[model samples]
Target chain A: MVVQNSKSNILIVEDEKGLRLGTQRLLEEEGYAVSAAENGNEGIKLGTSKEFDIAVIDLRMPDIDGLEVLKEIKNVYPNTVCFIATAFASYETAIQATRIGAYGYIPKPFTPEEFIYQIEQGIKQRELILSAERLKKEREENLFELASEKSRLNAIIKSINEGVLVLNKNGELAYYNYAALKYLNIREINIGENVIDKLPSKIVAVVKTIFSNDTFLLKTYTVQIEIKPNNELILEAACTPVPHPDGSLAGVVVTLGNITEFKKIEVIKSQFVSMVAHEMKTPLAAVQGFLNIIVDDTINVEKEKRKDYLKRSIVRLKSLTDLVNDLLDISRMELRTKHREIENIKVKDILSNVLQMLELEIKKKNITVQKNIEEKLPAIQADQNDITRIISNLLSNAIKYNKENGSIGIKLGSSPNYLILQISDTGIGMKPEERSKLFSEFYRIKNDRTRGISGTGLGLSIVKRIVESYHGKIEVDSQFEVGTTFTINLPINLN
Target chain B: MALIAIIDDDIDILDASSLVLKSKGHDIVTATNTTDGYKIVKERKPNLIILDVMMEEPDDGFYLAQKFRKDGIKIPILMYTSVSKAIGMEFDKSEIVPVDDFVEKPISPEELVEKVENLLHLKEVK
Candidate 1:
């Protein structure tokens, strides 16, 4: 649009020299910047060369028709308003001028006031055309920006991990990502199509629940569902209402997240609880038997035998307490493992500490443990308690399962990459099948040999976790009724 | 009829069971381990025997019960089933664990006495 407060440029063309000069003088006196041409050819040249807001062309020119000049001016600057000024104003000429993009024509030999009024109307028309063109361009720019933003959002939704589905108020799928299709296992889907029937029944139920509820616009509903009957894939859906500004529901947005791993962990957690219960029940039952006999009125016990029963009951109860503490230790070891103090530790110290702890058992079983160490043994970087647990559990097993006068051999050696600790016992050994299940949680050997041996059954499971956490290796070698050996290889450096 | 034997690895179970039977005016012979339990039962020929389900070996009582039947000693055997027995089976799955009667451990003193008297009375009728 032409800038306001600046003089509007005007152009006048005529075959008559006096008329062209007179019109120019009149427009100049009216505070307009004017340019005049004597013929149609000159007008075309001046019109194409400079910008003008309004043009007045005279018809019946000698060189060319005034309509030709107007056509050329309109082709160059479509926003410029053109007018036909003719001495003989006729019905045919006025219609032809209007078709050639002229605002209105002026008659020759008119008063200055009449001519000035026509000029004023042409200026207004020129401003309207320019303003329309500016508005159209601005609208096009805004539409382009909106298109780009929509594509950018589509790209993000398609790549995000969580599945997204947007449904219209009519329950037709308006927008969705590939993740949504994959999560739902929907093979064929199209825009603006109803896929509710294709959804799993649980999710469909959620949708129906949302659409049927009166307060749907005010709440978000969550549903946990398996993808299909007895299927491993689990999904969690959050159906949130997309509302209009007037507090009315426009559509429902469903976001789905895969929670199969989360469900598996829950199953493992329950299995762990039952295992604890099973292990605890046996000891508790045994302790109850002892206590029952001691308190019975009909059972008259001798004084010395009563003392023995009381002492044995207390011992069994103490072991039960120890089992509970051990369970807590195992749970704590599995969880809250973020903070741990790692430092250089001596295997020798750990072994000696374990030996001292199980000294009574070793002495009672008459087990002779021989320690063979390489000179100048290197220190292993590990948590001290973890190493102590491994040693004590294995050492106690060696003592508990050993036959009278059986020998236990300990060998500590170092290779280039590993610190090897091996403990061998001439004790009752496991069959290959029993050895295989040794590290399983709550799995104790159920045969005759292991019946006499009391244990919490979680020692080796904890040992395996610690070994795997440190990227170390543990191996068991056994021949039933012959002997068993346990080997551990701890890496010197951690990455 | 007064001679009764109880076999269990848990010394407290053996002592407690023997005390409960002895108070009922029965002579009690007890073995804390499986081998001695078998020896006492075979030698003494007790009228009825209470056997713990597990001793030095799991299923020691079951094996002893089978052995007693194989030896052609038909005196009633009271199986002292542990908690493990309740969840696994009540001597139902295996024909090998043949016994005349069953009593679960942490045994009610009254139940043990009642079971012993019933077995003796059943043996007299047989």
Candidate 2:
């Protein structure tokens, strides 16, 4: 009968010549390729260099004991299956052998079939472990590829115009894109910095509150901050928290968008609407008042009364015309339709002309006017009409808002670099809020109505535009109900 | 007898002012435009002048006032304009409207008489 051949390679490590030779011959007869080692020292060397299907060793050996040799073999070749054969048959030895990575331990005097069966089982176990390891390695490679692809996509998202930022669990900036850097004017050093250290005090407080509360999700917050170099940056920011798989807090992501221009346009729109209402209301009130007086039969129907009503109606009509003119002036200025016809103009002459034009209203009020114009004041190079209008508006505002027996003072002087004109009035002065909006188009002090004052509310705005065109500066100082002063500084000569 | 000349682009204002001065028993002459007003002032040489700020042109009255001062016309000119006196700014003792006196539009006949009488009285004392 022909013997079946086994493809398992087995190593017998025994110090006793009789036992070592006996096991090697038995394994070879059972169709296993067998190698024999005289002691643990040789066993260790063979186990390291050669890949054995199963390693069977005697428990008691001389020079580097069986347990020590078994440990060495597993350390070098973790996939090699190991078994211990011992005549002592002690429970402690069996346990010790298994603990040190042995497949199984058999007592001496065991049958040859039993030894073959243990060796075959160890070899099959080793093959299963090696295949499982290869499958694990392939899965890890695929995971790394997916992670790299995600990183590339995130890099593209960071380059967009909208600002994006991520903060770590410590409230420190983990990542910020280029757009966020530009919007916040953040320097390279600021990256990975603590959020509280980089933000303003107000903003830091809000962020700290959000960070401390795990349940709160601050989706949107609008804040205005002065960025580096002192530019007003308005941002509409949204914040969301990133959570770990176990429902613990991980980090926060914030996106900020600039809204400075949007705010400016909104303010302009509101001011325009209020201006239109005031303009229409003034004329309507005047017209209505005069008509009521005429309709009242109780007041004598005398020639004087009739003439007074007619004169007032005319005045109202003129006021309406002036309002329309002011609207046209602003539109022209915005469109850049008006061309400046620059010419040499005498400063004193222009002041005198403005004064003369308003002389009637001035004298009627019994207001004292003092003029301190220098005789040798240099002629200014400007658009004569623009200058005249600017002076006229300033002067008119003063007298219109003055009290009975009030006084106005005008001073004209020249410094080395500029010609200055200062006009002061003892009238219903402006409050801080009023003064702030004084030069804005269609902005008028609320109390000005009590004085029966009529203005297009575009006078100061026009003055500011014209002054800026000439590269001049206009400063205003006023105390509420006390007095108001406007100081204009213009270039001495434009040659 | 004090002679007063009134120059205004608006006929109604010119006529109304003349009526006020005439009622006060002062001799009055009226001109409707800058040219006629200037000629009348140079020829008649009134004791006082009442000028309107807004003539056919907005600064027509201002130009006339300047021309009168340049030509050595020393008659105390009182500028009467439709522009409100409450709107005229005051600078020191001299108000923005450069004149001996000023009266706003829809002028009360009583106020008109009172200002003219006082100005004439001031002239007499001077």
Candidate 3:
């Protein structure tokens, strides 16, 4: 085992040479490393520099007094223990030295045993003080580390993209990050504001439900809200409760995110599927009907008679092929793989061509057609093929679903910024529900069956998509069994 | 003789339709696509046009029907399609398929002749 050094380094400062020498000799014999100082000034200098465990100074010195020296040593080396050893020791002097941080005092004529005892007591007191100082330093370091960690957490909460809010136990806003402020369209800082009073009714209700329970727990609620001064902007937000450290009720922490775009995309996809199915069915049915005519031998009478059945079957078969091609076009457009050829085109020419194409069906139905395209209509810059497809689709649907001998009309005009095209037909109009989903892929009106009209249902969907890609808009007005009018607004100049 | 113009994209359908209409003791003109069908309609001026919804293109027949209306061509049209009855939708009396009548595909020979005769009578009455 290693032995601990009990001996301490002591400095004896006294003006009298004989007493100082005697005291130093006694301390050295007691296993202490002792140093000697002749005056108070020298004692103070030596005491400050050397790592002395204790100092023994005389009450009266030539340069500086013992109490003054004691004050200086205590101030400089607070941990170092001091003892007063003076020949002129009195009750008043001893009290003064002790008050100035002296550890112990011994009269000049004291015996060696008494002197050793006082020095031992001084060393013990110093050990206790040093241990206490080390503990306090460790506690201070821990407190600094905790404060830094809290600041880091606060910074992270503020930087997150999602809105974050913290409310106190009384449902008052305690903390709200920048994202939360923006999401709510709150211009001013709202800390300490009551959440129930400040937030909209829907959100306030959700919070109230979450915090109704006594025990602090994590709970989530969703609510719809309008942000900004504009009520048009809709947002879906989620609120959750945060618990306190003691497991008691703390404030609530809420996180909110926006999800408006997701809902619109889902509606478009469903409509596309239905239109494809409906369009394909019509041609397939015709093919089947023609096949039945050819197979039935009873119907055949002469060469000319037999030829009729074969000819009808062939017409239906060609229609099937056309339907397939149309489906392919739609697929390409949906994937955005097809690039449109843009050019300047005359609106009247396109409208006239479309009308000429439908002449046979119109005449057969005895439907009257009218055109109101102005002669001075300006040329529109657009993808000619896409515009043709758009106009053709609308006109076709109008005629295909119109009353026999009904009127079909077309109007074209141009304003400063836009080219307006309108097509109206005395066809079976659509209900509100049908109108809402008219632009959706594959959505057909419920009443088309009775009229025996056939469509792919992708017409309006394709038209809408093409118009949007060109940064234009389309609108429809229709009433059940009355008529339908489609209005297309296109930019005059392509940007 | 009663003249019927058959417009469809499929050569097979053109052949089959011609055979059916001819067998029914009616004169038939067939066009394999909407462009040719329109030409045939303008020249032949058939009493009735047998239009298919999908021909050379999905909406080709429908477009042809609208064109005829805009050009003031007044002829009775008979629209034939397979999916007409599948979706439970009916054509209104005044709509584009606003033909004298509509016939779903795979029709029997007897029904085809009967519908044709009835439409002819309806035309005479008007």
Better of 2 and 3 by DockQ: 3
Regions of candidate 2 where Cα sits further than 4 Å from its true position: A1-260, A285-311, A404-406, A428-437, A446-450, A479-482, B1-126
lDDT tens digits by residue: candidate 1, A122-178? 888877877888999999999999999999988999999999998877789988888
What TM-score is obtained for chain B in each of the predicted models?
0.90, 0.85, 0.84
Task: Give me the overall lDDT of model 1.
Answer: 0.82
Q: Write the per-residue lDDT of candidate 2 for residues A1-495, one digit (tens) a residue.
A: 011233677888898898778888887887778888898999999988887878888878868789998999889987778998888888888888888899888778788788777877876787777677778989999999999898987888677878888887787888788888777666763557777576555456656666788675536554565453333567756666777777677777777778777767776766675556545544554454455445645333467767776787788778788888988888888898998888888878899999999998888888899999876888889988988988999998889888878999999999887889999999988889879989987666643233246667789999999887788999999998898999999886775
- Could you tell me how far off, in angstroms, the CA of residue B103 lies in candidate 2 after the best superposition? 37
Better of 1 and 3 by DockQ: 1
Candidate 2 is graded, for docking, as: incorrect
Write candidate 3's Cα lDDT for A308-334 as tens digits: 655654664565565676677778877
List residue ranges in candidate 1 displaced over 4 A: A5-52, A55-66, A85-90, A107-116, A134-231, A235-257, A337-339, B1-22, B25-126
Error of 3 at A240 (Å): 2.3
Top-scoring candidate (DockQ): 1
Local error of candidate 2 at residue A29 (angstroms): 76
User: Model 2 misses residue A364 by how many Å?
Assistant: 1.9
* lDDT score at residue A61, model 2, on the 0-100 scale: 85
Candidates' DockQ values? 0.35, 0.02, 0.19
| Model 2 TM-score, all chains together | 0.38
